[model samples]
Target: MTDIKVDHIIETDVLVVGGGGAAARAALSAAQAGANVRMAIKAKWLTGGSTATAFSELLAIAAAIGHADERDHPEIHYEDTLDAGRGFIDPELVWTLASEVPHRIQDLIDIGLNFDKQENGKLVQGMSDFATYPRTCRVNGVTARHILVALGKQIKKRGVPIDENMMVFKLITDNDQNISGALGMNMETKEITLYKTPSVILACGGAQHIYKHAVGTSDMIGNGYAMAYELGIPLVNMEFIQIGPAAIKPSMTLLSGPVWKTKPILTNSNGENILEKYVPENVSIDEVYTEKVFPFTISSAAYYLDTSIQKELELNPTPNGGVWGIMPPGSEEIVQEKIPKTNGVLKAKGIDVFNDPFEVALVAQCMNGGALIESPDGTTKVAGLFIAGETAGGLRGPDRPGGNSLAEGQVFGHRTGQAAAKHAERSTNSANPEGKSHAALEDLADWIGRSKGKQELNDAIVSLKENMYKNCLVIRNEERLNDAMTYIQELEYSLENGEFNIDQENFSAAIDFKHMLTIAKSIVLSAQTRTESRSCHYREDYPEKDDANWIKSIFVTQQNGEMSVDTRQWPHHRKSEKSEVKL
Candidate 1:
């Protein structure tokens, strides 16, 4: 084994491994709890992760503060979330998110995060799909960015050390399987650093970028999921990834909210009305458009619209790999009024919504599944290692309601940060494990010693992404999933055999390929194992929900140097104050 030198060793009480909204919240809470906190981000602070990059006209955080409608309550929010999850959501997590998000929102407000309000000084709230009332809180459609700005300011105020351009690839555990520290590489200097901490929070977001068509930032490539999975953490609901319509041509912005209400004409590359051809006879275009809000789900007629576009692109290939959406001449004013943010973004890109045809495609937006947490505090089965944000699963289900993603990050980020700090306070074994550190360095050295050019590695990533997009996006089946799994395994074999080239410049890419392959295989295998059509994970072979045998959540784990798949019954029977909602 080639010896690799560790350039630096840093010590902290709690190490946060992401820079998104969740990570910011975690770091802030940890610092507030009086724990020495440090953050390692693969990209620049406040410039990466889904929370910083996600945008839409209706972008808001779901909180049942009863601002828009007095009828709204946490119970209603919990019920709607449970129903939307399609029998796979954890009841406790849903309740925690629904009940505690209001407090978290208030915390944000207390920290100088201003939400949009009406003339009466009442907060403005809008209704999102799968929501009972107008409970989504927003600020001119860029709510996430505003939230991040507030969070970034608070994070800076707390004096938490943040390490940017640091890619954490390994989680070091002691002999008792407790998290001791982590190993990271600085992307700029190519130097290795070991962070010694008693507690760690994995909030690195999702791997939607593994798909060819994704809306998340490039840094969100499954670093959290892969690291947790490698550490024997069970990943749940890996198959249920949320995908939705977004512009692919002029700019990569989400096509949601009032844009659908405008009744824009959707066409194939040849200008054929694809929706008319594929929408069921019983479903009208008006119904499809009305039902379409954001993410693609099998329960609604809007799926026909997404399916039509997918089929059209497959049959008649477009240069941009999307269908054209043309807004009516007079509807431009309505779009400008209703979806002003989306309209402004597109207008800046030189595509007038009234005249030019915009390219739209089904883009992977978020993952509903991730490392399964045992509590609302984002506690995984692994000791001293917690998860939050998109990195933690079981909190969401097959379909997450719009705006809940941001709410979930705050609710659980606060909880996880506090829990991790408490755990760190009780921890006595803060010493770095030399054995694990040496092994991690040896592994890094092996990769560096096998370094070659970057072309082959780049080609492999492109091919994997294309395959994942084609086989594992909105629509899926057993054959395609199996084929994808096989291809992924072949890629894994090639990577192990050093068939693809890797070098120092592309070392992050090489590590990303490994993480992507691990996550892709997990998704494919989990999708195949489910064998039922539900929510975002629609298996065409089994075209309907099999409630009898498939009401359980699928879990993927690494065991004995191979992938293991299993399922566990959801805790639907767990008693709670709001347990009246049934599957």
Candidate 2:
């Protein structure tokens, strides 16, 4: 407690709490609209958020895919999004995203987002599976990264105040539920920051790293999700976990997604394309693989590697799940380099993905749903608080469409910022009823400083990650979940014995991993309760969708350190007082 420091104060009309594509755009939009906005990021600005991991990182992704002419209105986009989300989406929320997506795409282009174009200046496009039109778009192949880079420079040009390498411990609100601001524990000096503002926006990204082996970065620990839930917010789709289909011995084959045409034939170690035995006839090649071969593990897993089919397969998007599809040119190299990164763990476990694709397993990648903050127009049940990008719900279900999330960041972040500003302007609440900001900051700073126990943080996290990889990814059953829950309990008990020493940067791996454990518990709990398979939550007991029994949303909220899950019935889409502000 003595080591704690209270460093600074940041006040703004609107506070954007993330640095990714969505957060950046949100801040820029708000600031440009004359709102005094400040953004805070937990890690290196864009690096920690989802904008860094998009498929192509292109601007106007859907436009590049095919809707270059605005032929697709928000209504069409809304229906397509709702359909993809499989009834779990918030009707009004989907309406919001769909309605604004097209104009937002145009806004990116207007702001110097260099999307790919043909000789005639028409947008270059392709179909990345299941899209209503050729909606998959790209510029340099990595849409997420490209957008991050561009948005990075774009925001830097605007000179927004940003604080990085800080841990936001909790959301602070007055008794009236008006968001006064947030409290943060500085990683460097163990001091805390108390922010008093009209509005608070959470742009914190997904909770994928909570699982053992993940393509997601270390910072992807559901911190934002946890904070929102702690504040009594509902997470829309907590059960939808996205797992990539390709792995060579437990290492993901990033480039392999675009290679080897026509769903590589699944072959066992015996070099047999296992599709022959179980894949029923009449299914499309994509269906034959994703719906049939990919799920079944015959003695491990089997996959056909045909370099010869590269051209044919790349033409048809192999990563058919997301809005971002594999673009040509870099497919082989991306696959080649990324596939081997999984070696250390796989080598330690004795599996070779190249020689045996089946031997390669899974690590966690992304969670499609989370805490229900507000729509782009920042108004949660808890007013004065807003959610952005991945932290806010009603965007994706268990399975997210590619390119859509990046778009989400732009649209919602901006909306939330503006709405928050509007709320602040209209609200009659006082900033501080009893001066809690300073107290809250000091308390958090002290708490962060006091984590000086002597348990091995890294080892426990590694174990947690490994356990999650085996139990939670791709294949899951009740027994596995139960075992994992028990294992996590013992691990948590052991963490109390470790030596923390309150080193922020030095002990970030520990902090990151600890947060992962917390988030993993929620995921497993939600996954365990659903008892049925749908989209990303594929339970062996309930392998098929039963709309009659499970047609609504899975609302998971955490209270009193316990996660409570409930089923929300889908409501008819209603249009609220639609704002007149259009890009």
Candidate 3:
């Protein structure tokens, strides 16, 4: 058998992986800093990630919104974020992001990206949350993607070497745990790419796809997070997950979650106004509903608020693809005709989103925290590696406040890229960071050439996704989680031990599934550790938030085949003493 050789060795001051907002920022920042960088994202050139489809970004344009009296400075934004995080976030990171985000976003605009504007030409902020002011800013209602498109064009113009359809098999390193380089496979040729570089930034989104019915795409299998764990990085707050704002995807045309106007009458199928049941504090219509329901809803049905009283005209938040889509912006006729699929889903499930009372589950959208931040410079505990964006934890600790994700990506992504570039500039090496032995190197060489034939990678990938969707979705218990985990593990094991084929279509996909399996286990294991109910770490056995002992982040690590977890209490934010945090 012929062995596949390293196609080519490329050296760079930095390597930024993934195409989401974080990676875009990383690539642009590093290149602007005069570092040679290579960018890679899984899957092909189209729809690479959820951020690709993310119509909103909460960070880049907050203070520039249309609301004339909006008091949105980074400081106020920081506090609101801290409060939303439940204080589990590392104050340093939160403070850093909050302080610089407004400026950072403005910088993005200055760099050729344009945010959507109102009739008066002010930057438009969508109905976003997490601050005393409106924060989610968009360009024609698509924030990150717009930024992504711009960055892609700019990066291309600069010619800073990027590989499309490149699957990151794993991070390659030497004995010192310094990230030397990475090994990837090209989707077109089914070839192995073992490129060595000094520093790397991992911005590969989150592993939300590990769960069934995820708001994210199947590509968000947490490869970066899983690879970090495999290579000895401490992942933090893996227990905190975030379901979305609505029971259905915003992309859904017909059936949609209620609009803000319907809050006064929001109810579940059981005829309960969720806001009243949870807050009991007679709040106004504009308060974040997640903040009200998250504490208890995790252990119970997600959201079943009563909205029976709202007039038909004022309730709708639906959209069709592209622009000019109505968000339940009109009357019931729009929903009935345009997005009847979702409407039918609601009606079939006996949900009356229109009536005084209706129930809808805010499906698990994404994970908020994971892979503890060990670097003040955004470095993981791993020497040669860095983590940014959603996969890297320590942004918001307790619970992620709404509208802060895009900011963290931009701010920390900038930091991670710069720091990594500096590290690359200082270092000079061409060996694996983990000191791969001769035998290990030989094994890698052997595995590179070992595939035989008749492998259906897509089938396995589909099965894994379907299983995840079915078993690990909105609600779960030990029995179901365990079953799903086992099934996933078996599939991973089969791939590892099988002798079917090489370079076959399913080949790289199988590799992807392997990574997905690791990520899936991380989710299940992390979920199993936090016995106390809080936020998305809901437990059927225990249905109440026990801040007494469970406020800490659940940390997980895996070695060989065993997984262990350690918990750390949520950081204490002394709200009484206005101890200042400044830009």
Q: Against the true structure, whose lDDT is highest?
A: 1
lDDT winner between 2 and 3, please give it.
3
Poorest 10 consecutive residues of model 1 by lDDT?
574-583
Q: How many steric clashes does model 2 contain?
A: 34
Every candidate's lDDT: 0.86, 0.61, 0.62
Query: Pick by TM-score: which candidate is best?
Result: 1
**TM-score (C-alpha, index-matched) for candidate 2:** 0.79
Q: Clashing pairs in model 1?
A: none
Mind giving the per-residue lDDT tens digits that candidate 3 earns over 1-583? 3444566566667888888877888888888787888988876543777667653223233442324335555567667777766546776676677667766767777788777666976666644445576666667545667777877786777787878878776787776777887877788787666667878888888876664445556678777887788887767776566654344433221212333322324443344444454543444434543223432234323332212111110132212101111223244665454345444555566654455123233344657776777754688777868888887887755466555777777887888878888888888665653334334445654654665535566667667766654445444467767787798777766666654454545556655677777767667777666666665555556656777776667777775667777766655553333223211
Off-target runs (Cα >4 Å) in candidate 1 are 1-3, 450-455, 577-583
lDDT of 2 by residue, 451-537 (tens): 677655676777787777667765567987888888877765554444454455444455455556667777777778777766656
After superposing candidate 3, which stretches have Cα over 4 Å from the reference? 56-70, 117-122, 244-302, 305-330, 333-364, 430-460, 499-505, 574-583
Instruction: Put down candidate 1 lDDT per residue, 1-583, tens digits, no spaces.
Output: 4456678999898999999889889999999998999999999988888988888887899998887887788888888888876457789898899888989988998999889998977789998888989989997668998998898898888888999999999999998899999989999998889998889999999999999888878777898999999999998999888888888985588887578988889888777888888887888889999888677888888889887878877887567898988887778677867777778888888988788888888898899899989999999888899999999999787778878999999999999999999999999885556678988777876976765434488789889999998988878988888889889999998887677676666777788899999999999989989888987878889989888998888989999989999888776734557422110
TM-score of each: 0.96, 0.79, 0.77
- Higher-TM-score candidate of 2 and 3: 2
Q: Clash number for model 1?
A: 0
